[model samples]
Target: MKKKKQEEKEGEEEGRKSMILLSERQMKEIYERAATIGAKEALKFFEAERKKEYKGRADKRLGNTKLLLRNYHMLKDHAEKSVFGRTQMEESALDILESMMSMYDNEVIIESIKRSATRTAVIVSHIETMLGLYEAYCDKSRSREIERRRYEALWDMYIAASTMSPKEIADKQHVSKDTVYADLRIAIEKITALIFGVDGLTVR
Candidate 1:
């Protein structure tokens, strides 16, 4: 009986490995297909929205950055409902999966979903799990531009202060130490505004 149980466990593990390999392969192919469809339509919409939003402010750098971020969200929503497929989970299950992002990063959530996919029989498994994984992957890749902004200000400050004392940073930037400190403060504020929007900090 002990030998039989061990053999059963080994068979299950091998089966899981096979399933994982096959599912991962399929996901890559489907992702490429989704990307092809997403690129053309997303670009067209983004361009139109950019021109519309920046009609008279072509030189407004911060305004342009905000508009691009907003347009990206629109693009992502369109893609989610279109090429990337839909969630098959219950509303509660879906909410739990999304909430997982707070505790686990995208890469962790995606791999967990992929591994989870191996448990169900091929014909009976829920496609929602795999779709969620793919959507997470797609969002991560598509948001690369927005993610870049998350570090923009910090990077600038780092560049200014990397090899210099705070005093030197002020001298190099043509400002007093107080102003250098202010510059660093403003850099953080800019990153926060870009990420979270300016409305919260705005005074009516």
Candidate 2:
């Protein structure tokens, strides 16, 4: 009877292993498909938005840095919504986004300074500041991209680790943690495809 029980335990373990493999494969497939669809839709939205260009003037009388910072905050709010889609990101991602927004804010301020300042030294300082901000922005953008990829990877790992339990994985990631866990469900389905074979992962 002990031998029989041992055999039964082994069988259950093997079954679990098989299920894990199958779940991983299925999750990967689903991730790719959803990512592809999301990418295409995001691209379409970006292209449409880009085509609408409007001209604006910077007021020299106003503190350009403050105004630009305000605008940056507004845009950042919109960007966070667009990127995370109601999901809270890790502190790292938020830091990178904030830095990028600050760079943009500084860039606008420097441009205003260049136009308004009469002293040659001040103009040069503004120019230097703008250049520095631009470089910083580029670096931050790259880092943000890396962080985003990491987030996706970690999420997938969590899903696999949790045995495809949507609620469990969400809880681990500190994402939704409530409701029906729709975001996590969609993310797992789409991210699997994205990591495996989907193309055009560019942000829209």
Candidate 3:
């Protein structure tokens, strides 16, 4: 029995070692997203005692681990909100799940996210796991910029615009129908470049 427990401990440590840490920019983005989802307390937790300068990867990892382990509740809230609309599996609630074990915990959360069947869910799973890596790997500001740009260019709402007619779009945008078409083309090209970082897209 002692041998079995020793093996399990070794296995968990090995799993922790395998988890990848997120880039600093990525962590910033995660924080921003967490904030957007009303995770003020979690944000406060992350904000506390942040390293002014991570001397090296070792320094960064240790800092992140301590941050995540201590503030997992915030990540938990963020994850739950990310999948708010989806059916919580009768099998489990994401908020109640632990992320400390790495593989097993991640798999369960990922399954729950998948069952939610939304792009937001997938991103949330990635964010939550990345948070744990810091606790164990570990931005939204840029995303808001991207979204603002997309809306300005496309003149559309991801959730609501699909139901709108071109006339309605023109009316809402306060532009002529022809202008709306032209702007939409430019918008698509701009968005393509922002996402793909290629200038090859042209308005047609």
Q: Across residues 1-204, which tens digit of lDDT does each residue of candidate 1 receive?
A: 999999999999999898777577789999999998899889999988876654423223333223323233332333344222235332332343333334434445333333332221121122223333433443476665433332332344432223345576566556577766655444444532333234212221
Clashes of each: 0, 8, 11
Tens digits of per-residue lDDT, candidate 3, 79-159, equal: 565544446434332332222223334444444434443432434354444333322200133455434433443434222
Deviation (Å) of 45 in candidate 1: 44
Candidate 2 local lDDT, 1-204, one digit each (tens): 999999999999999898777577789889999999999999998877654321111111122222332343233333333323223332332233223333445655444333322322322333235434433443466566534433443334332223335455556556654432554333333332222213212222
> Where is the poorest 10-residue window by lDDT in model 1?
117-126
Q: Against the true structure, what is each candidate's TM-score?
A: 0.23, 0.18, 0.26
Q: Which stretches of candidate 3 lie over 4 Å from their true place?
A: 1-120, 123-157, 161-163, 199-204
Clashing residue pairs in candidate 1, if any?
none
Return the top candidate by TM-score.
Answer: 3
lDDT of 3: 0.43
For model 1, what is the C-alpha lDDT against the true structure? 0.43
How much lDDT does each candidate structure score? Answer: 0.43, 0.40, 0.43
Output the number of the lDDT-best candidate: 3
The true-versus-predicted C-alpha distance at residue 72 of model 2, in Å, is: 38
- In terms of lDDT, the poorest run of 10 residues in model 2 is 53-62
